[model samples]
Target: MRSALMLGSATLCAAISPAAFADDVLDNPFFKDSSTQVMARNFYLNRDFHNNGPNTQSYREEWAQGFIATFTSGFTPGTLGLGIDAIGLYGMKLDSSSDRIGTGLLPSSGRHTPGVDKAEDDYSRVAAAVKLKLSKTVLKYGEMTLNLPVYSTGDSRLLPETTEGFYLSSNEIDNLRIDVAHLTSLSTYAQSGHNAGGMTRADVYGATYNFTPALTGALYASDVEDLWKKKYAGLSWVKPIDDTQAFSADFRFYNQKSTGAERGGDIDSNSFSFKTAYSYGAHKLTLAYQAITGKGGYVFYTDGGNTNYLANYVQYAEFTREDERSWQARYDFNFAGLGVPGLNVFARYLRGDNITLANGSTGQTEWERDLEAAYTVQSGPLKDLTFRVRQATYRNSFSGDLDDVRFITQYPINL
Candidate 1:
């Protein structure tokens, strides 16, 4: 990994053409401004037991460290402005044993060692992107981190996920936005490697309309070849009840079907989610309900053929299950209003039952509880730095035993 980083750094330096170094070429100097920013992060995670099914136990503990660096340059002077962005990432195993390996936070290959030992040593990746802007729209190509509902990029591990693709976004209309994109390849958040054999081509389009100051709606459609095609529509509304209190509501519906090489026979699925929240003083309370109605279950893209789609959309409090129903209750408190800025706490509980497993099993029930605390530096050189800790416990009557604990800290700098 160190060698790869050195090689990539050298390539970047060599790729900068002398013609691109000229100064005072643009009429608007701000448009051609260039800057570089660096961000570093470290993560540690450990789990005492892993239960695949009822009475099953796989116990192990592990820890890892990761670092990420990024550079961005403004477009050169011209009618058609152009810019470039680069990202480099690396991860190393700080401590881990063979028996408790495979945390998905780092790359693990080959067979696991018997008894107890250490896992792999390290992994890394480097990516770059180019962009062009005109009027109120921008076109970008290369590695990207997508954040849309139907085709969001994953960032649950050492590094943010990246996709090799092209994307376009326009905000020409008043209070309206449009997004269109095409992805050709994908790399996991761990930056361990890229998924070359999996579904590589994907197309997505979405539009958002802000009807009023407090209300908005969006519609999106995505065609992911060799995977599932999905359509999503949602609405959000907020109403302030008082100076410091407000009520918010969100509703979303999803329709999905398989296509091309990813056609898992024939699948038809529909999912709906609704959330309502109320705020009072420094406390906020939220309740959500989600249900899936279809021939099978909710569909998601997973590189290792894992059926459980428990990613971003599925929160710690609730998960979208196949032919199942779930609900969650959550409470959060902000300390900023209480004279302690940049501190917050949250807790949630989720329950799901009546799940239909893929192997023709039925009558399954599961529940999970999550607790989290986070804080950020308010003023100083470390301002905007954030620290977070979370713990979760999951139990199911039929799905086996599951328990986990995670801790993370991050620093974000804007250039």
Candidate 2:
């Protein structure tokens, strides 16, 4: 990892051509005018255990404040345009203690060791990226956040994960998009302190196409050093029955195999999921099914935090264990349909069974239920002020029962 980081840093220095600074500094569009935005978020989380005794932490709770600022420059005025992007992230612990930790809102004092109880007060980081654009194609290098099918940084917490790498994207052809990248390292949102060389390395290639206004498809492949090679393909489609109703369908599949000296041991796995939804006016309903079959669970790069792309990736569990099968039913309502323009409600339930663990136990079962309600200020002085509440419950054959809740508020301003 250290060697890879060094090579990445050296490559970035050599990629920026001297032509970028040829134009007059004041006249270049990249520097003359730029756009900026700032976002402030307040978050609180609580989780209570029903069976884990007092010897362990009986409950987990925390409160934190987060701020994110971003700046993006316009391109230079020439056949070859040059630009830059910058990001600043900060997280402050508003309320926490040694006895009540493990919420991931603040970093722990010790590393990954278990049964430790200490949290940091705050953390902050700054990053910048250089970009070049020419004839509908763009190249970028340095630190940035990515949210693709194979690799997505977690942003549900206080701060988002950012990676150091080089990226290439092209949209020169109609209805087609191409992307490729080499990611060396990343700092996760859960890090206690910043370190650029602690993450695994990977190479990714992907393509997407739009067959029609109602249908889209994608294919992507990635290789993680000392880990596994992964391939993913998916499709989504929507049809309008009338002005007041619509139907949509989504399907996704993943295939993985051990690579490079069998890093995670011999691995062969396949996972697939499907979801269908129907909407009428402000009401929506959905149904989904997902399953995994192989000698081991579905594989992903775990050194840096990663999120699954499956439809069954719910609030508590992904239901991607070896030989597991799961299904979901969900409902959502928009209060605007009933005259309240800023309120909404959602609920979902999921169940999984047939989990095969290394211990040779089979037929294990688990289930979870989630509910949420939210509102935003639609007009007046606090136009964009938002508030949300979430509650979830989980029960499994081995881990006991759990309940959790979260409260969140966000405000943003453009500068």
Candidate 3:
């Protein structure tokens, strides 16, 4: 029965594609009304640390390969057009050891690996969605990625994080976009299966307004049942100081409180961050400051997945601390104007002080320094292939000392 259903869905998708692209065919019977495209990506990552602590690993390394396939069909004929989309994700481990088991780069089950007993093996997931479009608004349901500022879906690891939910978005108003979503279930990187009975119900709402070509503002609220409720707002502005120079500024504020089962007790926090950047030709410099107030500092939500990529402000880096103050300085350069079209480099330093840990320790300080370089193929058969190397060193009065190096190569193809 399941096989039959899957086959029927695939057949329907094929039948709808031609009709979806009919409008684009200029009196050509062979022209289809719909369009379909697929994107495939492979990512490799390696991490090694110099020292280990009770809470940290001394040396860890991993290499993972992943493949993602997506297919989309255009809406059928009608005022309320409907379409179907499917996505398939698979990941395989290339290297790792028991000492690096919790790196979140692969899926591990209990004490045994799925395909390999001693060695971690492979995992895969398949998801499908139904989409509807009415005027300038679109509604999507099923497995998807959440990308709101307050509740962003992470994509930091082998596979992008996904949620079982429904999302509605509208761009009916010029320069403004509105988004709202509800998530009911989740699956994490540590597990290959879905949990429909978990404590993972959330409601998210937000709107972004582009006041001008160079200025924008956003506001959002999220109610995460059994976890936390948060309200976030931010604004960003950019202006050209001169023909060859530009300046940008950003501000963000978050207010959060615990809720439901996860809230053993009432806890509240308020956090704010501000950043300014200046660019001259191929070089850019940025400075940022952040502060935390209230009893709690910040709240975090994770699906326990390998995909840890989140908002820039939420990253711990070297300056993240509870009720602590921090600052960062960064520099970046593009080598395109220097004749290396697809090369870029960046370095940043962050420092924080006055940390409050689990123990009643204050006046604790920490810092981090990070460097990264990346390049991509601009043309030829391997065009769009990218390579990156990142190195970071962290030292904290409470968290201990750590150093890490990572290298990744990505090949992205769109069909």
Candidate 4:
């Protein structure tokens, strides 16, 4: 959410960390740089709906535990170095019942009932990718996680989503990067199979340039077979105002057009947002303005795990509708600046209006408020362990209202 383009982000199918090797494999270039890691996650979610549709559940609550194991091998020593990466994910349901389900932490479907067809007790999946590196460029085939603006796989749950196909990343040019991918399949965390969301072919391309030491720009585009075509451009600038203060500004633009079969209905929209932030000492303030104009809202691949890099993409609402406009104000405090090394707190509020309904009505509005605090163990047997709590409330003039809270704990182990 901070930047329109998430460059250099790790492809974690729940991923992370250094190349800790075994004694025997230290001599080989491939094994010397190979490493393994496992992340243990505990998640609890509770969402209360104040206004619900008829015959629908009022709330959803669930607790679950997850383990993500990842392994990466260094490239072999040659002109075209070859390597492989693998990931294993497992999730176990800890608490849930007929009345409380649909937490997204565990795979579930069908009506809200305590039956075999509802929620499973445990689920596990594994995938691997093969890679070849030539100079400063790498090409990968098979399953992997993506974090591009045009096709970012979601990692907001107990596990991360993944895609299958050919991907290329090139940093051959100075301060510039080129990314190209042909995605053929997708796997969501809330589903069991690798292609649980169905198989669709998509072509995505992106380029990023670092204009200066403190300025960067990016452009990305995608074509989703029969759904739509999207293009995005972004600029980010940051300046330092002494040793303890800084300022930053970010701008993002997106254009979409329905193509082929037009599975998303008639769509022609342009969306843009600008956000600015100032940080002095331990306090930081950010304000953003965003608007969408067209016949319909901004259209993107939700099922393929694509992300909206707009500033107003909040916790419960996107604030993106026909002719809709939204603004956000946020404050953040790092406890480290206040003599607490591993603590942080954040609060933000957003309000959106000028919405145009399908029936041609306008002026409806919506708002979302969010608060979160996080703590990490700085020094202890469980060093680097993190615990976080988040709360959000959303209200709309023409839709359901919700109060949502989440508790999360994570521990990473290297082996």
**Which lDDT values do the candidates have, in the order given?**
0.74, 0.83, 0.72, 0.87
Identify the superior model by lDDT, candidate 1 or candidate 4: 4
Q: What is the lDDT of residue 218 in candidate 2?
A: 92
Best by TM-score: 4
Sort the predicted structures by TM-score, highest score first. Answer: 4, 2, 1, 3
Give one digit per residue, the lDDT tens place, for model 1 in 1-415.
9999999988887776444554335434434476655555667776555446454336655677777777777776667778888888888888777667766676655644424334678888888889998877889999866777677766666677777789999999999999999888777644456763265788989999999999999998888877778888889999999898999999888888877775544568888888899999899999988888886667664422221222214323336667888888899999999899999999988888888878878778888888889998999999988888888787887644556777777776666
Model 2 scores a C-alpha lDDT of 0.83
In the range 2-21, model 2's lDDT, one tens digit per residue, is 99999998787667544444
Model 3: worst 10 consecutive residues (lDDT sum): 303-312
The global Cα lDDT (0 to 1) of model 3 is: 0.72
lDDT of candidate 3 over 170-193, digit per residue (tens): 999999999998888776553466
What are the RMSDs of all candidates, in order? 8.9, 10.6, 7.9, 11.3
State in Å the error of residue 116, model 1: 8.8
Which sections of candidate 2 miss by over 4 Å?
1-28, 31-33, 53-55, 112-116, 192-198, 261-266, 301-306
